[model samples]
Target chain A: MADQSQPPLTRIQQKNRDLILEGALSVFSVNGFRGATIDQIADAAGLSKPNVLYYFASKDDIHKTLLTTLLDMWLAPMIRIDPDGDPLEEVMTYVRAKLEMSRRFPRESRLFAYEILQGAPHLTEILGGGLRQIVDRAATILQGWMDDGRLAPVEPRHLIFSIWALTQHYADFEVQVRAVLGPGHDPFVEAGPFLDNLYRKILGL
Target chain B: MADQSQPPLTRIQQKNRDLILEGALSVFSVNGFRGATIDQIADAAGLSKPNVLYYFASKDDIHKTLLTTLLDMWLAPMIRIDPDGDPLEEVMTYVRAKLEMSRRFPRESRLFAYEILQGAPHLTEILGGGLRQIVDRAATILQGWMDDGRLAPVEPRHLIFSIWALTQHYADFEVQVRAVLGPGHDPFVEAGPFLDNLYRKILGL
Candidate 1:
């Protein structure tokens, strides 16, 4: 597996780790967590399962790494929503940011979708701690906007959920969305204008 | 299993068949399609799996029945969005109806969620045929509204997606919503005012 690991992984360790994870993401995203096998992941990485495990402890470990990584990316856009910024612009920023993620990292989005759809069984700790807390803070920001009369009155929390569902739907249900939208329809290009007008109308700013 | 199903289900037998299906819905909705089992459903119907299968073929059969049934119910409210009604009111009615289902029949919502999450493998045929067709028609209705300048000019399909995501989020993500909103918060109650004003703002009437 590497000539007794040749003094063990050092700087090269991080690069191989990233390689294995990239392969794992492609496999896991397509098949789902339970549906995926360690052997398949190893083969995809061009390493043995034990070798893969040598880099990461277990399948769960690999999954956790992928999820935490994706969660950081997912929440970055929401974290950028400035309570101090213009109301409609802030919301539009959030919308475009999320849609952009769907376009750029659809596989990551689908993998996250698979996890949540399965009830967040692996990342309950992350969901309960980091993700949930961030959503709450953002929801509070929206509430603050409503209170200041800078944003139109609405359920700040559900509004966020709508943003998430709409943006993520493009990825999670991409097959169905594409099927229904037909071949020529690019949901992202169509989606940006739709969302911009949506926020403008909802915020009424 | 029962002497050729005890002379086969008759017209009266057909009525009993409906009763078994009715009972399956209550059980499947609460426990989810997978969490639900033949035993729980049979117990709910005061019968055995063999007897249940006599009416329907398998657990998949029962779950498929529930899905098809709910699809009709789910689409009915949206279809009732009168083409001639006050356009804003029409959309608002669709919102209220969807939220009402989310509140009143969350089990149905979860059942659908679980099915879709599992890639709708079992119901892909029905989904491709029935559900997709219905959404197409609704999208057309929405386009009509946009065409008449009755609703804000947005991608009718995405507008529909947002409305769905907004309303269904209350039911589908109730646990997370409750956790963040605090234990005492009733999401629907909080959501009602949020949705009412949201539609009003978006419709701009």
Candidate 2:
């Protein structure tokens, strides 16, 4: 095992870490944090348990790393909502970005869902800290838009919540979506226009 | 231990079954299916493992029972959408019912979310059968509303999905909601008007 005080990871160490994280994402997304195990993650990563432990001290450590990384990526789009952009366009762009994330990074979305579903035991601090900060900033921008009559006045926080709920549902609840849509139905392909119309109508744009 | 082929449960047996199911909901909702154990359920129920087993065949059996029971309750609101009522009223009623379910049956909502996140391994048949039937019938009603220009023309199915996403987000993501809103924020109370305005605006009511 590598020493706790060791220098920066060599190239090989970095690669192994990535592998472990990728495997952990799949296992944790499907099985949830409590359901997942180091052994399962190790097996998925094609590494020995000790080898997995070498990079991350414990299952919790690995989970923490994964969650922090995910939170950053998950919040990136919201952070990118340009304050100076046309209000409707900014909001729509954020919606599409969120929907695209749902389609492309479904496992990541599900992982976050799993954490939230269980009351966010591991993420309470981040949720209260980084997440709160970013969301507050974004909500202010949305409020500004409403004040300018650029969008229909609504609860900024709740409006953001609505956008998350609508887009992430396609990924987090993929099975139900597919089951209802039946075979050969790609939800995202249709979701784009469907969501655009709904938001446009709601915002009175 | 009670025999598998025994006659109907006595009053004592009925009481024990209720205790076990109630306990199972707490454990299973927190831990998800794979993470939950019979011992945990038994402990929660204040029963011996053998006694718990006597009442239910296995963990799968217990989960299946919980899921089917939940499905019925979950779909009851959709089933109540009146075909002959004012289209907007019918739709909003369904929305309110679903939101009420989110507030009143949060554990059940999270339980269903857990199942769906893992690909609905335990609920495929029900989703395709009962759920599909009700949603399809509701979609037809929504389509009728659109046909009469009582509601804006949109994909009825996606609209229903949107409602579920919005309402359920308050429940399933309760932790995030609470974390972001901080103390003194009751999402359900505010959610009622927030969602009502959203649907009213979207439906052009």
Candidate 3:
């Protein structure tokens, strides 16, 4: 059956779907797309297979729902990177916000990583419409910063790419990172100074 | 039966194992550990189920062998980064080598991505023994560069992490990158100059 309940669903459907998505995030983040099974997701969700199927038509349907929902939240911070703000400050804010998300929502980050690693088979449209357009707009803003001498001349797209790589590394490679940083090193402590220096040095204001 | 052939395997044995590994990489890279099947890999290698099992005891064995082999090759260039060389040049050479590998051996890159993405389930020991040790030595070399002011002051470990993230992003997130860059764009062409400027600016020599 379709989700007949509207945007703000009745308490029961809301609770059930929320539970399923939360459980699904954990399972999907670790096992990845092809690796995740409906049974695992159902078990993790504490719902029977038929009960899960009652909400989502199939495994692919559940995955698409999670991914599209993720895309909305994932694009929010970048959308908040105001084109009108101080270039350095705006970009630095974006960097810090992204890193904070990596620390706080590592599961979501890994889930995204798993999908992208598997080639975004279920997300070509979202990638095209949502992510691609936002990146283009951000690139245009970055180019303006370069032209205005508000930031050092760097490839706008690559600048965005570097920002992403530097921030996300903390989450995506946490195992390797923590191992090298040593026990109790706390990546966030180093992350602040490291990012501060990176932005300062790169922007060259 | 195990791989009973001695170190000096007959040409047929060598070729057969190589074929199986090639097939295994494709399956493993596209699908994470839990998602891949012995049937698919065996079929890809042109061997019956039992014939494939003769070469590799189980699917896990095949996956482990593939990752172990990749780890050896993956760490080669870093091991070759001469500490005695000019710091910028040494780092640059390492960067170029990694990027080149991303282009040439993309499947290996993707295979490694899949493993790490899944928490490095089978290769944690290798990470500690092989990868961590090499990173330690590499970090020391980078520290020397920083102490001598041959390279800008940055955390050696994080610098290495940055390089890995930036270079690997091209191969691991190829779909998203290509999608945004558009149909006509060649990522490597733009990537080369972007990275050259990046390290140069970051090192600030």
Please tell me which predicted candidate would have the highest lDDT against the true structure: 2
Candidate that beats the other on DockQ, 1 or 3, i.e. the better one: 3
Candidate 3 residue-wise lDDT, A1-205, digit = tens: 4877767678889899988888889888888878888889989999998999998898888888998888778778888988899899898899988899888888888888888878888888877777889999999998998899889988887787777777777888787777677787888768877887877788876
Highest-scoring model, DockQ: 2
Superposition error at B201 for model 1 (Å):
1.5
Candidate 2 residue-wise lDDT at B87: 82
Where does the lowest 10-residue lDDT sum fall in candidate 2 chain A? A1-10
* Local accuracy of candidate 2 as per-residue lDDT tens digits, A1-205: 4568968889999999999999999999988988888899999999999999999988999988999888888999999999999898999999999999999999999999998898788998889988999999999999998999989999999999999999999999999998998888899998999999989988875
Candidate 1, after superposition: displacement of residue A82 in Å?
3.1
Top-TM-score structure, candidate number:
2
Q: Which stretch of 10 consecutive residues in model 1 chain A shows the poorest summed lDDT?
A: A1-10
Q: What's the lDDT for residue A119 in model 3?
A: 84
Query: Candidate 2, residues B1-205: lDDT per residue as tens digits?
Result: 4668968889999999999999999988887898789999999999999999999999999999999877888899898988889888888898899999999988899899999998899888888987898899999989998989999889999999999999999999999998888889899998999999988888864
Model 2 lDDT vs. the true structure? 0.91
Which residue pairs clash within candidate 3?
none
lDDT of each: 0.77, 0.91, 0.85
lDDT of 3 by residue, B88-122 (tens): 99999999999999888888988888777778887
Candidate 1 local lDDT, A1-205, one digit each (tens): 2566456568768787988898898888776776678998998888888889999999999998898887888789998888889887888888999999998888898787666655667677776677778988898999898898888777777788778877877776666666566668898888888777777887775
